[model samples]
Target: MKWTPQDIETYLNAKEYVDTAVVPLLAVSVGGEMKQSAAGAEFITLLSGHLERQFTGRLLLLPPFTYLKSNYGENTIRDLREWEANLAKEECKHIFYLTSELDWRTQEGGLIGTVIWLPSIPLEHMNDSQKMAVVDSQVKQLLELFTQKWHENQ
Candidate 1:
């Protein structure tokens, strides 16, 4: 579910079943003029929309956490962990941070949850079929990750 009033109401009423929180980690360029970087951001948004639709009420999709790529550092990861703690209080046991940027390499001990980083696909120039194919593959991989987490928890 997304951050809408209707969805939030539904989520609150069904809080026990909504155990997962998916947060998209987006990196916005300084000026938002570079085409490739902008495309990555759009791809994250598109993929995130697909994720929300697939998981529906089981997943709470937060807005993209935007930051400058050049400024990515320990503090960013720290803030993400803090956000994870806040979400945990809301009863979300699994927090997934989805990103396309490869520069955010950090050790697992520092993070409070899982990070799913898929290569960015430039959908702006692709035909409709090509775009659909990429999204299909990405969703399949995400499902596998979610399944793995479910078993680990079990």
Candidate 2:
């Protein structure tokens, strides 16, 4: 479904509903230390905290699923698809995928993140800041959207 700003407004207004936002970040290292890197941990912690604040009593943060191998196999895709489907069934209103490309040989590894707002917020209207927020703290943005929608509905 196309997500319009009004839809975001509507979802935010609802009294009680399950809403979820996903952020997928990719990292690579020569020694598989990226998972334990300070930067990685800090980024995840920041995003988690932000979401928690936004959702307050209604947020559920899923554990981070990291991929160390780069085969990009069919099974990998299937697993991701299944994850998305499960979130959908849980009545998730937002889903964000944050990705980063790593080139160990070139030492050019960095973050490239994207936020996917599902079934509710329209993709077209999202600004750069909003998209970045998805990587940083998408839950807060979702909560903002929810709050806006709630007020409008009333």
Candidate 3:
């Protein structure tokens, strides 16, 4: 199913906060013929804009790294772990993963696709409400963390 801005907002508003910090991660996939690089750039731009408008603090966007062909899942997990480590060094408090599926067009006009997101994170255990809550908290905590870190660094 397609995600909409309203969906994100609704989910965020409906979340219950625990003592844990949640980070927002987005995985986006686009059609192979659709210029994945450009799509990634656009997606980040849109996401950042949304954050700025809806949240009260600054948010940091990470650079996207391309996944290799072999053991993509394992690679994703490793990437996330490294990211977490780096953030930890910087005293970052939250981390979230977002994954997306994209369809690619081939010469035959058939669609090819890929799934991109951090690996090793389990989604099967989360109910719809729980997932929504996670998403909401992820966004919220990211902004919070960013602001907290920014001030500390200043």
Report residue 118 deviation for candidate 2 (angstroms): 19
Regarding TM-score, does 1 or 3 come out ahead?
A: 1
lDDT of 2: 0.46
Arrange candidates by TM-score, highest first: which order?
1, 2, 3
- Residues 1-154 of candidate 3 have per-residue lDDT tens digits of 0134654464355433211122333343455623544444444434444454554222233444445323346556556567567655654444333333222111112201111232222334677677555545545754665556436545
The TM-score, computed over Cα atoms with residue i paired to residue i, of candidate 1 is 0.91
- Error (Å) of candidate 2 at residue 97 is 3.2
Ranking by lDDT: 1, 2, 3
Model 2, residue 108: distance off in Å is: 22
Candidate 3 pairs with clashing backbones: 23-96, 25-98, 26-98, 27-98, 27-99, 27-100, 29-102, 31-103, 32-104
For each candidate in turn, give its C-alpha RMSD to the true structure in angstroms: 1.8, 12.8, 14.6
Q: Please, what is the TM-score per model?
A: 0.91, 0.45, 0.36
lDDT of 3: 0.40
C-alpha lDDT of residue 66 in model 1: 80
Where in model 1 is the C-alpha error above 4 Å? Answer: 31-33
Q: Pick the candidate with the highest lDDT.
A: 1
Q: How close to the true structure is residue 123 of candidate 1, measured as C-alpha lDDT? A: 91
Select the stronger candidate by lDDT from 2 and 3: 2
Task: Return whichever of 1 and 2 wins on TM-score.
Answer: 1
Q: What does the lDDT come to for candidate 1?
A: 0.83
